[model samples]
Target: MHNILSVSELSKTYDSRFQALKRINLDIRRGEIFALLGPNGAGKTTLISIICGIVKASEGSVRVDGHDIVADYRAARAMIGLVPQELTTDAFESVWATVSFSRGLFGKPANPAYIEKILRELSLWNKKDSKIITLSGGMKRRLLIAKALSHEPEILFLDEPTAGVDVNLRRDMWQLVRSLQATGVTIILTTHYIDEAEEMADRIGVISKGEIILVDEKAELMRKLGKKQMTLQLQTTLERIPPALAAYQLELASDGNELIYTFDAQGERTGIVALLKELNDADIVFKDLHTTQSSLEDIFVSLVKEEK
Candidate 1:
């Protein structure tokens, strides 16, 4: 995993009063889907804006493909494609024309074949001649992606790419992202959809209050923070946890129909065997039993709350 983008002690303060981003340090690996997760106003957008030259950083530095973002603006900006959260585009311009214009903005020569390929890849070929204002919300989102990729950038930044899209469109966008990754394009996306990150990201970074709280491989993060719960359908209703099973820290359901035992999924011993043995000793019987693994959403919420 090569570091294609590097941020060292990056800080952004407005009017020397509001710190939008704390001293943030990050390394975005080449050819990987890195998901940035944060709550609203957590500086996710601010960080991406600085990297894409949309916003100026108050202090520190950012390097895109070993080129300083500010000192080597052309080279750095050329290697990155930013799909902003806002859907601001020339309403009268056709999809094909708009995307082609974006390529020209990067000082790249016109390449009709490349533009055609990008349009087809995003399923925008049929709508290529259609005015931007006439396209559906989903098509507009796809057009944004096409515009970003027009210049053939090495890194693609998707800022809430699927934010307002329908479920089918969102799934299509995920498939499109996967296709882009297959072509060796590194992707860094900031999304409110935790499940989307869990499904698409190779690595996950959690940011809170402008500071990065954790960064880990998606699977590794799940293993480290994920928990498992053993749910027991009790044969008889109980008002509270039995005194005999106090050591296990069992939880009694509100309806008194289930007993829940939670433990770390990565633990050497889950203590289920001991817990069941104790239940047997106490002559407590269960009608049914089931186990469930914690989701990435659970881990994300827990991490953010802990940071707060």
Candidate 2:
């Protein structure tokens, strides 16, 4: 549970007086997958850039593994690797050369074994001699990850890693992420795909209007804020709801052939028994009933909307 990275009172303001981040304070735990979720213009990129030493914070400080990003820039930057949102790479460079070169940029001595290991792990071994431009989009994306891992960084930042990838590739990337975690790499990702975060992260952080809003364990966050809905397929279609069922605030759907009741998942009582009893008294029988809980995307949308 030790912190591998820390940001304190971080803020960013551009020349036009646009404050990109507002007193943001965050701690990334060692060997944990932390997902940072936010709407566009919410400082997700700005914060990552600052941590990667690409952009300077207007005020405050960041430390990577006890090394201040500003004062001990080399050490701080060396421990972190960033896979940016955009696919920026030399089109003419071979996969092996590009990855090897990235490690050298960090002043890491040439470790061909390490480079080969990462390329193989990323499924880029077959394409090691392929020019960057010759690889498919998915292969290029994997190459970015290979380059990031070339220097054996303890922390990896994946910014919108699967943004435009197909479903199959996304799942492949998910598997890759889990394997990386098994190797004890701390992962901090900023993604627009909420399901990606829900599936991969140990904890979730929400930022809005350039400020950190909420951070919680994924399951706990969903449990606290998630709601459940029960949909009953009625045996008989009804024109309207009965007066006695007013308390349930149910919605008639499927042209009155279905009744949808939403209830708080965290409530002391869900009132299901009472609802069934009332349905029996009203002579309303349901053919079937199914319940669904809130999804991470639902909670994310609500949080962002609340901020707006």
Candidate 3:
């Protein structure tokens, strides 16, 4: 797929002389779910804001479908929709009125049928006449989404979209997101929930300390950085691992009744067979063995920790 959004040499600095983003370059493929992962104060929000035209960049350029964000601000911003982290809305305005107003803001002609479709999809049809202040947190979250989709934007930015919502809302939001993508809407989300990104993202971009640390296809990333651990339940307890097993770098656990071996699953050879044979030679028998691969969360935490 071709890139729908391009960010080149992006950098952001506040008046206090603090830099939030370094010279960054990124391309977001059209109609793909791209997840931007980073720790707090890691420039995820700064980058999103710049793209959405909410904040000015210190030095760089952004383009939406080849429309320069600065030179073609109207066209670039028109194609994008942003669901902000804050739950800001007109308290006294009815849901339908607020969503309809959003569409008008983008110079879109009145389309009641389209408005009703989104309301029903969001399960807000029954509450369409209710005031925003009367809605619960989850309902309010859904309203924010409805407004973002009001203009039928080609690109959507969900910043911590499911942060404080319930399980049901989270599930519903993802379902809606999928449907939107099916209709050719490109998705870019910044989320604290690693599991969400792991399950949904087509590609993952990790940023750290104002720098783009890594960006890769999700499956390729997991294969390259992911580790696997094999745990062996010993037949007998021991005070320490045998000298002969030192090369394997096994860790003794469960009061020396278990041995943990870490290896790269993608490696040419994992050394599992050699380790098992060596264990037999040392008379260290295992009653049971199981293995687990590191999750995206594990890789994300380790990556951020390394930056620190």
Candidate 4:
């Protein structure tokens, strides 16, 4: 569980008026998939840019494997691979040539075997001879990944890697990320897809207004913040909740045909049994009852709203 990256009191401001990041502190563990979730203009990409040395921080410091990103730019940059949200590549260059050029940029000795492995893993081997402009959108995205991985970085930064891709391609990207993790590579990704974060991340961080609101283990975050709702279809119309059942915090539906009970999902006892018994005592009967669990999207929205 070694820390592969650390950021202390990181802040960023542009044009001396707009602050893009705010006092962010984080530690990314080795071989872990950490997902950063936020709305557009929430600084997810700004934070990534600063960490990758694409943008300078207004204050504080960052270290990649103990190498200062600012002071040891070469070593720090060399240890990281970035797949940006935008798809920009040499249009006329062959896929293989472009990826090889990327490795060369890092001053790494030519390793054809490693390059071949990366292309095959990304399903770009067949198109290695094809020009970048000739490939399909999905193939171009895969080529972006192959190029990022060309240098054999210990950490990979994926900024909306699956954005604009089809479902099958997105799934393939997820599998590729898993395979990369198997090789002991640490991954940090910024994504708009909450389900993707829920499915792939070991830990999740929510950011808003250039500030990190919460960071926690994905399951623990869900359990701590998640809420459950029970909807009961009343057999008869009720104008309002009974005074006796008010303690359960029940909400009467507008149509007067349902009662909704909201409660914490992580509670040791949901008190549903007691509520049901009390309902029976009050002569309140329901025709049907259904329950639903809160999703990651729900928790994320709640967190961001609270920050505002």
How many clashing residue pairs are found in candidate 2?
Answer: 0
Residue 196's C-alpha lDDT in candidate 1? Answer: 98
Q: Which tens-of-lDDT digit does each residue in 1-308 have in candidate 1? A: 78999999999999989999999999999999999999999999999999999999999999998999999999999999999877788799999899999999999999999999999988899999999999998888889999999999999999999998899999999999999999999999999999999999999999999999999999999888999998999999888777989998889999998999998865526498889899999878899999999999999999999988
Q: Residue 122's C-alpha lDDT in candidate 2?
A: 87
lDDT (tens digit, per residue) of candidate 4 on 1-308: 89999999999999999999989999999999999999999999999999999999999999999999999999999999999977687799999999999999999999999999989888889998999989999998888888889999999999999998999999999999999999999999999999999999999999999998899999999889999899999999999888999888999999999999888865526579888989999899999999998999999998888888
lDDT by candidate, in order shown: 0.94, 0.93, 0.94, 0.93
Off by over 4 Å in 3: none
lDDT of 3 at 267: 51
TM-score of each: 0.96, 0.94, 0.96, 0.96
Error of 3 at 73 (Å): 1.0
| Superposition TM-score, candidate 3 onto the true structure | 0.96
Candidate 2 per-residue C-alpha lDDT over 258-297 given as tens digits, one digit per residue, 9 for 90 to 100: 9998887655265887898899999999999999988999
How much is the lDDT of residue 273 in candidate 2?
79
Where is the poorest 10-residue window by lDDT in model 4?
Answer: 265-274
lDDT of candidate 3 over 1-308, digit per residue (tens): 89999999999999959999999999999999999999999999999999999999999999999999999999999999999988677799999999999999999999999999999999999999999999999989889899999999999999999998888888888888899899999999999999999988999999999999999999999999999989999999989988999998999995988999999865526599889889998988899999999999999999999999
Lowest-scoring 10 consecutive residues by lDDT in candidate 1?
265-274
